[model samples]
Target: MRVGIAILSYKRCDITRHTIEQVQRHTKADHELIVVDDGSPDNTQNMLEELGVAYIRGPNCGVVWNKNRAIYYLHEMRHCDVVILLEEDTFPMEDGWEQAWIDGAKRWGHVNLAPSHWPLNDRIGGTGTVSNPIISRYVTGQCCSFSREALSVVGYLDTRFRGYGHAHVEHTTRFLRAGWGGYIKSGRDHNFYLIRSPLKVTCLDKPPPVADYSKNGDVFNSIRHDHIHRWCWRDEEEMAVFHTSFSTLSRSGIPVPTISKRQWFLSDNTDQNLVWDPETQVVISTPDKKDERPRVIATVSGETVQFKVLRDQTFWMTWEQPGEALLKEKRSEAATFKLIYGKNGGVGFFYNGLFLCTDHNFNDHIVLSRPEMKNWEVFHFSGFSDLEQPNNNPMRSDRIQDWPL
Candidate 1:
C-alpha cells in the first residue's frame, strides 16, 4: 500500500527532528512524509529545510485546522492510499511499524495506531485475519492511519474546532456516525510499541506558542460533546513503556535470540546468578525451590518491583512503572554488564542497543548521541541472523581480545 505520513508540527524542533528521522530511517515501504508547520514563530521551516524535510508553512491556524489541512494535503493532493497522522510528540518505538497499520487500514476502516491499553479490545472486536480489532465507537487521531476509502467517507476533520482538544474524537465520531468502523492498535503489542516523548528533556530553548488547554476544553464543551462511545476499557490513566528487545535499538539492529530457562552469572566477582525467563522477561533471586515462590527481583525491561512468582514462575509487567527505571536498576553502580550466552555458539556480552556516535571513543557505558556504525557493540546470540552492517568493522582487536563472560 502507498502510505503517506503527515506530521502537524508547531515547534519543538528536537522532538520533531527525532520524529522525522526515525520515521524515515525505519520505513522500508513506498511512503512520503509531509510536515505541516502551523506558522510557528520559531525557525521550524529552516530547521526542517536544513534536515532536507519537505514541509508546508500554513497560517497560524489552531491544531484542528492544521490537521485538516494535512489530511487534505495527503489524501486529496498526494493521492496516497493511507495517511499516517503523527503529532510532534508521539514517538514510535519499533522499526517498520507503519507497515502493520498500513495493512490494518486495508482491512479495518480507521486505524488508531497509537492507542495505549485504555479501552479493552473486546469493545470493538475484529473480523479480519489479524487478532487486533477495531473499536466501533471511539478513536483518537494521534499516530493513526486513515485509509483513502475511510477518508472518502468520513471527510476531513472539522475545521470548526478551534484547538487541540477533541478533533480526534470528533473526527472518530463522524466516522462511526457514517457507519464506518474504527480500530485501535494498542501499544501493548511487541511490534506496535509506541510511547510519548519523555517530558523531562528540554528540547526547545524558548517556549513556543501553544493553544491553552483550558480554552480548548471550553471550546470542546461549548460544542456538540455528548457523543456516546460504548465504554469497554475504563482505565484512569495509560502508561507507555518500550517493548522491543535491547538489541533492536542499535543502529545495526542486532538480532539477539531471546534467552530462556538458564542460570547466567554476571561477569563481575559478585555471585549473582541471573536466571532469566525469555517469555516472561523476568528474573528471580536464585529460586529458593521452597513452598513459597521466589520474589521477582528484576525484569528484562528493568522493573525492580518485588512480587511473588506465579504458578508458572512469571509476574505481570505493570505499565505503571517506567522502562527507564528498569534500565537504571540493571545498570546499578556497575558501568557495564556482560550478558553471557550459555553454550550458545560465540555469543557474548553486548553493549546497550542505542544509537552510537562515530566521533567519540568506544565507551560501552553511555548511550551515544546519534546513529552510526563506528562503535563495536557485540553480544552473543545462539543462532545467527544477517548483520545489518557486516562491512562496517567497529570491533577493535585490542578491546575485545579479553572477551570473558
Candidate 2:
C-alpha cells in the first residue's frame, strides 16, 4: 500500500534532522515523507531545507493543528491510501518499520506504532502481528497510522485542542464509536521509540514554542460528549438519535441484538417469508422483490420501541382502535413494542403485563393485549408467522471540520 509519512517537528533542529534521516534510511516502502515545522524558531527551517526533504514552515500552530495539516495534506492532497503520523521525538528503530505500520493500519483502520515505554524490554514481537490484532479504543497519536477509511469516519483531531493533551484520546474515542477497529502494534518488526528529551536549545536565534497543558486540558474538559446509548452516534439506538441504543447488531455481525431479546428489523423478514405492512398495521408475507418495500428504522427510547417507516414520506405504525393498525405521518402517537424472548426463539413484548400472540390458527393478527404471553411467536420477529421483533441499528457518518490554516 502507498503510505504517506507525516513527520511533525518543531525547534529541535538536530533531533528533527536525525529523525528525518532515520525514517528515510529505514522505511522501505512506496511512500511520501513530509515534515511539518510547527513554527520552529531555531535553525529547523534552514536545516530541513539543507536535508532536501519536503517541509512546511509556518507560525507555531500547536501540536493538534500541525498534525492535522500533515494528515490532510498527505492523505487528501497526496491521495495516499494510508497516512503514518510521527512526532520528531519518535523515531523508527527497525528497518522496514513502515511496512508493519501499513499492515497494522490496513488490518485495524487505526493503529498505534509507538515504542514500548520501558527500554529494557525494547524488543516487541511475536503475537503483535497485524494478522493477530489486539483491539482497543484508545491509541497514542505520538506515532500512529490511520487508513483513509478511518479518516472518513473519525475525521482529524478536534482543532479546539490548542496545543496538546487530550486530543489523541478524544479523537480515538470517536473512531471506536464509528466502528473502526483501533489497534496498538505489539508484534514483530515493530520499531518506533520515543526520545525522552528531543528538544534542547540554550543558544539559539529564537526560543522554541512551549506547551500549555492547563489551557488544553480546559478545552478538553469543556467539550465532553457521551455515546453510551443516547446523544452519541446514529448507531447507538434512540435509532438515529439514542443514536442507533449502543448498537443493535451483535458481534456475529448479524442483524440481531446481543441481549436475550432482539428488537425489530424489517430486513429479518426475507428468510422467514414475513414482513410488516406499515400501512395495514399487520405482519404479512414477504414480497418477492425488496425494492417495492420501503426503508424502516426502529428506535428505542426509555422503555418503548418505535419504528420509522419511510416510503412516500416518514410514517409511524399506530393503533387507532383495538385490533386496527395504521400508519401515521407523525410519531407523536406511534405504536411501541416490548419484546419477550421465548425458550426457543419465541418472544413477547411488555409495556405493563400486556403481551401479544397469534390466534388459535397461529395467524390472523398481531396485537392481542392479553393477560399472559401463552401464544408468543417463536423466533419469527415480525407478524403473521411470529410477529417477533429483533434488534437492528444504524450508523450515521460524521462530518469533518474545516480547520483553516
The model with the greatest lDDT is 2
Q: List runs of model 2 lying over 4 Å from the truth.
A: 118-127, 134-138, 183-211, 226-405
Give lDDT tens digits, candidate 1, residues 200-303.
22233545336555555565556544433311111110000011112221222323223211111211112122233444444322322232423222223211
Whole-model lDDT, model 2: 0.53
Q: Per-residue CA lDDT of candidate 2, range 65-129, in tens?
A: 56766775666557788998888877776677777678767866776643354233433333355
Q: What's the count of clashing pairs in each model shown? A: 5, 24
> What TM-score quantifies how close candidate 2 is to the native fold?
0.47
TM-score of each: 0.45, 0.47
lDDT of model 2 at position 368: 42
lDDT, candidates in the order shown: 0.45, 0.53
